[model samples]
Target: MSLTPGLRFSRSAQYVLLSNVAVPYPARLPYANLRRRLNSSSRPRAQRPRGSPRTVLRRASTASETKPAHGPPAVSVPFDPKSPGSLSTPRDPIPPESTLNPPATTRPPPLDLPARGPDVSQFSYLFRLGKAYMQFYKAGVKAIFTNRRLLRSVAPPSGTASAGGALPTRAEVLLRARTRHDVSRLPVFGVLLLVCGEFTPLVVIAFPRLTPMTCRIPKQVEALRRSAAARREASFRRLAHLRAARGEKAAGAADGKLVAGHIARSLGLTSGWWDKAGLDSPFASSVADGAVAFLAQDDALIRSGGGVGGIEDAEVMLACEDRGMDVREKEVGELRKRLEKWVRETESSSEEDSKDKVKRLLLNHELLV
Candidate 1:
């Protein structure tokens, strides 16, 4: 049977970049001065030393340089807008070199002018609200469209079996879905489906002892879809297989046995039956019994007298390997190829040794324990 294609994220990344703006740079202060006054009053006249010719000349030179005949002092301090209090400090007779260069003025934040109306604040607020509403409307419309598409995809195509007819196996539906849809065109949609498919086997494999009566059904489809889609896009987990197993458990919880069975039946999971089940976070024997009950209901579909057809257990297992509950189509073709090789090897074995080769192999791998 054909395998599903790999999935990828869509144009949604473009909107992510558009939603935020960059922060503005801050301003700096220029040429500032600090001065400390000397207490001349503390020194008594009797304690003062007599001035020599060298001291007299030095004092004269400093006085002459400090006050120029023209305009202002040669050394000027720049004004600071941020802290006007600095202006109150007295200047020292000899200022630091920093006083020569004024600090830069702080620039005001960029003015965001409103596109409409004389009252900019009012206009800006209204504009933001309008954009928000438009975004909400777009999201709602997109969600409706996506749900409709998914429903159509899940439903059998023209001339296929009706709702109550003998359901197809999970393998058959997947093959058909792969053949009909340009999975690449579906963007993250394909990945979401893959994740949903992956969940079943992961749960079976990872938590074989836990059974499945205690998983919680997810309340948010969007969250589930987005998560699955993201996993497909970001295929870098070290233990992807293990992660998929956990996700499947979550999916089982989200899709109660009844709804899940109905969905499975609709998708043609003929090998199974749907039974009522309950899930809580903690493990419970009662919940396992509930799962057994659901599986019993699916027995009718499994026992229908139609031929086993083209699908096989290996195919179903491969689908689980590929789609896991976290990532859709992340490892689809790889698992399918592996299963196909196993099938080929099984077919080549002698009649006496037909001995359920897949089952033997799974046993060796501890996959079916």
Candidate 2:
């Protein structure tokens, strides 16, 4: 069973991208010119006395360089040697004392640009594994179901002798089943690993906000199975408890009365509460009409009772406890009685079926173990 051509193509594209990101990126200086300017301003200025001819000459040269080169040249004005007199007034607007020598316009400290997140190359191994797994899964399932006709031929009805020595025997059919089981299981395992490998890193990096739902397909499937078992157990227990409670109520037992009174006390009581405060209620209400219809079988047994007898329903019920309406203790007890009877009946049926299977197996074994 080849992978869907599209999936393979997409996976290949991902690989190319992953590999590209792998080639190390050279360390680059994005703003070298701005950085150089900032560094130059921080140097100390010369502190030579103004009276020195060399210092005076250097200052004059510096001033000449700074002034506009195309403007009119300075004209020599007669100086009163004995009197201190100002020269031509400064033409450029005077900078404010506060602004004139403001701190150097140091380029804002080189922006501390955030580091780029890890590159996609980090996911290559996982991507490859996922691709392989998906391919195997697609093929494996197809292989098994595709040969159903062959499988049917190998598995014959019990007790009927075949022209060719009991039609390869039941044990032979089971062995073939086991082979098919491997074909099914391998792909499933591969898919599981692929899914985990693909998602685990993403969850780790994303933390709380983007955490992957831990229930991946494989884990979810396993969890579903476990939940199914728990559901079955919970149903059985609930039914048994209900039956016992109902019997006690019928017998005028104190426990039954106490439960009913407690339920009654809790019905329809509203209280002041802070916005986030939590409270517990002891009684629950159902749509009375719906409950009647449920009991009346207007819907299928599963739909009406909401899986009261099925594993699926039991699971949903457990999940709803935190959010669902409260139930009256007396009603709960009565419901439990009916469930307990149903459980006993189911168990009895299963036992009878098991007995029948064992007898059939023994009879078949006599001919071909």
- Top candidate on TM-score is 2
lDDT tens per residue, model 2, 284-359: 1222222222222211222222334332222222212211122122254444344333323323234344333322
Score every model by TM-score. Answer: 0.19, 0.24
Assess the local accuracy of residue 344 in candidate 1 as a C-alpha lDDT between 0 and 100.
47
lDDT for each residue of candidate 1 in 1-369, tens digit (9 for 90 to 100): 543443223334444344333322221112111111133445554554459978978887897454211111112223222232121112544232222211111111112223665655875767664554334323322333332333243335546773467454332233233323322333343343244442432332332222211111122323444443343233222123433766652223343433333222222222211211222223222343343333332222222312122223333332333222222334544444444444444442243243234223322222211
Highest lDDT against the true fold, candidate: 2
- CA shift of 180, model 2, Å: 12
Name the lDDT value of residue 332 in candidate 1.
47
Off by more than 4 A, model 2: 1-120, 146-149, 157-161, 164-221, 246-369
Minimum summed lDDT over a 10-residue window in model 1 is located at 101-110
- Global lDDT of each candidate: 0.32, 0.33
